[model samples]
Target chain A: MTADHLRREEWAVTLPSLGWLLALFAAPTLLVFAVSFRPADPYGGIGAGWTLATLREMARTPLGPVIARTVRLSALTTAICLALAIPCGTCLARVAPRRQAVLLLLVVVPFWTSFLIRVFAWRMLLHPEGPLKRVLVTVGLADPHTQLLYSEPAVLLVMVYTFLPFAILPIYAAAEKFDLALLEAARDLGAGPWGAFVKVFLPGIGRGVLTATLMVLIPALGSYVIPDLVGGPGQDMLGNRIAQRAFSDRNLPQASALSAALTLAALAPMALAALVQRRPPALEAAARKEAA
Target chain B: MRRSRWPPVVTAAVLVFLWLPIAVLAANSFNRSRFGSSWEGLSLRWYRALLADADTWRALRNSLVVGVGATLTSLALGTSAAVALHRHRSRLQRLHYALVYSPLVVPDLLMGMSLLVLFVALGADLGLGTVYLAHTTFCVSYVAMVVLARLQDFDPSILEAARDLGAGRWTVVRRVLLPLLAPGLAAAGLLAFTLSIDDFVITFFVAGPGATTLPVRVYSMIKHSRNLPAINALSVLMLAATFTAVRASRRLLQEDRP
Candidate 1:
């Protein structure tokens, strides 16, 4: 009714969520950073005091390969998703407006289904005696003994499959807003279709491309289930190791250290983008726009 | 200008790639086979087995309980946060915005691990309660985002008009605001429920030995290759539910549009 009342109402509304998040989200994130410095007790608990021992141990541990592998796999997944999504998004954008909603729903239905189920489906499809393997073998594309399950390529393939919709939606959102006349103009200026696509269409949807990359890349980096289910021992990513430390080794501090490293790695590109352009990364901006 | 065939070809290929595995899984759910490597014949034996499995039922129950609890909690918190965020502009709200937004971007693994550490530090037991807490943490952000989007098209004058007509603040909210926000809230609630129920990574970390959600149960079943056909059956059911919920949410949102 009044300014004072409105301000009070705002605070009243804000405080509950603010307190909840602070207690749960903020405090826990800070706790991860704090615990990363603490010692791991032998009995699956944090030790009494703080130490750099965990960080020092992490430095000496052979995490380089895992980190490198995580980045490589995630980057590859993002690249592949982008390549596939560009055309898919372009096609969706060009579809009849009435059919666009149905097609988008088709894309989203698989995404909204249980993530584990999708990953499990991949496991089934890639099974040694599965139909896919049998078909490939029959076509002389694979040795009969060769398994499609449990390999780096398997992980990459599933990751691309899993995150492809994420990439496509954002690109489609951007492409839908793009002007078609620009392409015609580019063609009129003597550019071939390929040149017009590369020169005009790509730049036109640059924000969407950036958004799609981050959407795919960030989740791929933090992926645990994909690599664990479909990947071999040699394909352990940072996520797998982080889970192993917490669940198997019961090393809380080490797990915290790993999680902290992952949090930084995930946020690094976003922060870097923000710094370079003096604006929030397109992912966050796109999210806000989507929310609005 | 002539239309290139590349877009349609690529689109079809990608769409098939997306749906093939799901279609295979759905088809195999009816397969009267043990391994699900090949189809024997169309039958509902796996579905019957899934119904007979007590463990799957228990996990599904746990998922429903957590899902409903998290959805209700996040709806209240997220709706309030969204309304406050939409109306207010200040440094504190900006900080609140960051708090709300960060959870959306933070990796589930990190969020799960961090919460596990926090629970361990606080000596809280890992169980469904912890999973509920963990889920509400992220669900609130999603709910807020959805509500905020709904609020973007809202007209503040309607509220002013109600107030001028001698409606009290609560009356205005109850009579006008809540009705207008109902669609957004329902969509947000459905989304929250779906996310909470389908969540595995976070629930995996926070859930005690006794507190297995459906996804976690499905994960172990997949790992052990136990009753593979039954998992297919359950996957099909869950997928059906997800699709229905998504469609319902879309319909609600579309109906809300002028």
Candidate 2:
């Protein structure tokens, strides 16, 4: 086929998908950007007036606690997921090929279930009078009547549970490509364990770390259900607030602005991941060449 | 060689943490206690109740319709995009990937919120149709991502060889490319179906009255009522379906891998 013919074919193949995305995905996002700047109607519909007031109103709204709590929880969740997933990924990468597949299957199978149900399951398990609570009491971790549900810790636990697979998947993908000999070489060159990890191991898996961070942090920040079912009303996150402003209160403009703010927050990690993901290939290829 | 003991221990512990709640849910589904506080005895009464509820069946029907509709549409769009990206390598492909992946990063709350606003702006009715559209929008990204990954390792010369035999472009795609892509298509289809069925936030915003999905129904049931057994039974059934679909797709993809 001629170059022009292939190019024409490419466009032909791409147009339908791109057009669908542009219409349903991209344009709708732009609409959100536009709608965020519009004034709210008296009754709940959007009005004609255009202003920056809605955007600025995000500052004055009492969203500080929610934002702070969300960031704190997301940070903790991301940290825990990273801590756990890194080892899991390392284990996965080091295992035999058959064992690796089985382990991965085990990791991924639970995620196939409804995430909502999984979260609800956590609610049941953490119920003040549930079996898990009984187990905890019997194990002497807590006295009977100790409330495990409707608490901050429950939200954090569920978030970590829900997002651990996300962290582990990318980390495992990156770690699979890792050259284990590099770690040995670093250690043989008189580097201490911590030094080997910091200089060689960490940099080798930087892309995975970045990907896992973005995967865990963004979703953890936007999570509402965990908090709603487990954390109670006082523990509302950015997601709950946005849902409330839009659905319950019928306040679209403020909700739009909050959504925009959330998009900004989530975008930060995505931007970092994109940068990390792009740069690693060039660096790795160069390293491979040098080693050869 | 010194073996690190912590990795397996930590991994197993994390796995336990992950499955413990699910195990609780599964076990509680069979427990007779209304609160699942204690296992009085094993019973299928909750399952009987779940099976008997008309609303449950209606919601299940809606979820199935939505799942099927979204998956089919997403497979079409996502496969095309994957094929295009695979065939056309350029700087623009990076932009395509970013655009394709944008929905994955965009919080569901925002994705749903924005679409709700857009629908209102367009004066579109919020119903099963809107839910399908919203599900399709996000699901396409997942499908595209999965298919694109599969295509990365695909050999392009097969298409050329087929074309060299005087096959038309459509014939080459149909006779050769589609066969190779079948596993990816199946995986993407199942992924999209599962995602659509489990989606709550997006459906919550787009669904109008009389269009409740299973997740939305379960949420309301949890909020409005205290009975946990029926919901547990329903969740277990959904879980079983999801597990079967995922296993089937994984088997397909695994068998095709070189």
Candidate 3:
């Protein structure tokens, strides 16, 4: 086929999905942004005129605290996931190939199961009258009346559990491709063991660390189920408030505002990363030479 | 070449943290007690109750219908997009790539909420049809990603060879491309199906009255119902289904690697 024929064929093949996403994904996402600027009708619909009232409302005390709590918890979850995943990925990379496959599969199994069911499992385990509480009481580590479910720590714990695999897989993928001999080379160059690790090993897998952070942080920030099932009223995150506005409160414009804020917040770091990546080639080359 | 012991120790501890809840859930599925606070004894009563629950079965049926619909639709859309993406380079393709990729990064809740707003604005009644649409939107992105990864290692010379052998355009696609793409298609289909059936947050927003999927049903049951053990039993069965599907997809992908 000629290049023109191939181009026509490509357009033919691409148009269907392109149209579908444009209608459902792109248009709807833009609608969310547009609706955020509109006024909420008292009857659970968008009003005739547009205004910035919803955006300003987001800065008020009620939603402000939820946003803060969401960011804090998500940041904590990302940090904890990184700390655990770095070591875990390093070990998986160091293991024999056959064993590495099995270990990776183990990590993926829980992730494949239903998200709701996993959260429910945590609920069952952390139930006030459940076996865990019984064991803790038996070990004298907790009083009989102590609660495990519907607490901030429980929310954090489950958030970590839910997002841990996401962190591990990317780090493991990057680590698997990483050359371990570099560590030894650094050590031979008279760097201390810790120094070698901090300087060489971490930088070698830096891409994975960034990928893992984004993976964990994005989902953890938008998490609705974990906080809903495990967190009490005081621990409500932005997701919970968005859900509340959309469903219970029937405030569509407010929900859109919250959703828009969240979409922007999630995309900000990615945009920053892209900007950093688009630096001048000369600068990149200079940085490469410096590293060498 | 000496390995530090701390990494393995942390891995084991993290694995335990991951598996303990699942183990507890599976074990309690067979518990005779209603609350499952403590096991009275091992019994299949909860499983029996779960089997006999009409609402649960109906929800599962709904999930399967939506899953099959979404998977087939996404496979067609995603495979075509992947092929076009792999073969072509242009500003339009870049835009297409961004559209295909954004869903993967956007939060599920936002996707659901935005779609809900769209439907509301269009005066479209929410139902299983809306749920199917919402599921297909995200599933297409996943299927495209998988198929694109498969396409990365594919050789274009195979298609040229078929054409050089006097095969028509349709014949070459039928005889060469489809066969070569079958494993990828199958893997992507399984993944899409798994994701569609397992989805909750999206379905939760789009589903109308009498359009409840399994996850939505289970969420309400967990929130309200007294039958905790039956939910446990249901979760175990769902977990088993997920394991089989994921394993099969992995095997297909592994077999395709040459």
Candidate 3: residue pairs that collide? none
iRMS of each prediction: 0.9, 1.2, 0.9
Q: Tell me the tens digit of each residue's lDDT in model 3 across B1-258.
A: 566788999999988988899999999898888778876998999899989999989999999999999999999999999998998999999999999998998888889999999998888889999999999999999999999988887899999999999999899989999998888999999999999998999899889777999999989988785577888898899889888988898898999566
Worst 10-residue lDDT window, candidate 3 chain B: B221-230
Model-by-model DockQ, in order: 0.83, 0.75, 0.81
Residue-level lDDT of model 1, residues A1-292, one tens digit each, is 5999878888998999999999999999989999999999888989998799999999999888999999999999999999999999999999997888888998999999899999999998999878899999899999999978999999999999999999999999999999999999999999999999998899789889888888888888999999999999999999999999999999999999999999989998787655645543675688799999
Best by DockQ: 1
The better candidate by TM-score, 1 or 3, is 3
Among residues 3 or more apart in sequence or in different chains, the pairs in candidate 2 whose N, CA or C atoms overlap within 3 Å are none
| Candidate achieving higher DockQ, 2 or 3 | 3
Instruction: List the candidate 3 regions with Cα displacement exceeding 4 Å.
Output: A56-61, A276-284, A287-292, B256-258
Better of 1 and 3 by DockQ: 1
- Give the per-residue lDDT digits (tens) of candidate 3, residues A1-292: 6988887888898999999999999999999999999998887878888798888887774666788899999999999999999999889888998898888888999989899999999998889888889999999999999989999999999999999999999899889999988988988899888898898888788789888888888878889989999999899998898899999998999999889989999998688667755654666699899999
Q: Candidate 2 or 3, higher TM-score? A: 3
RMSD of 3: 1.7
Docking class of 2: medium
Q: Candidate 2 — which residues are off by over 4 angstroms?
A: A1-4, A274-292
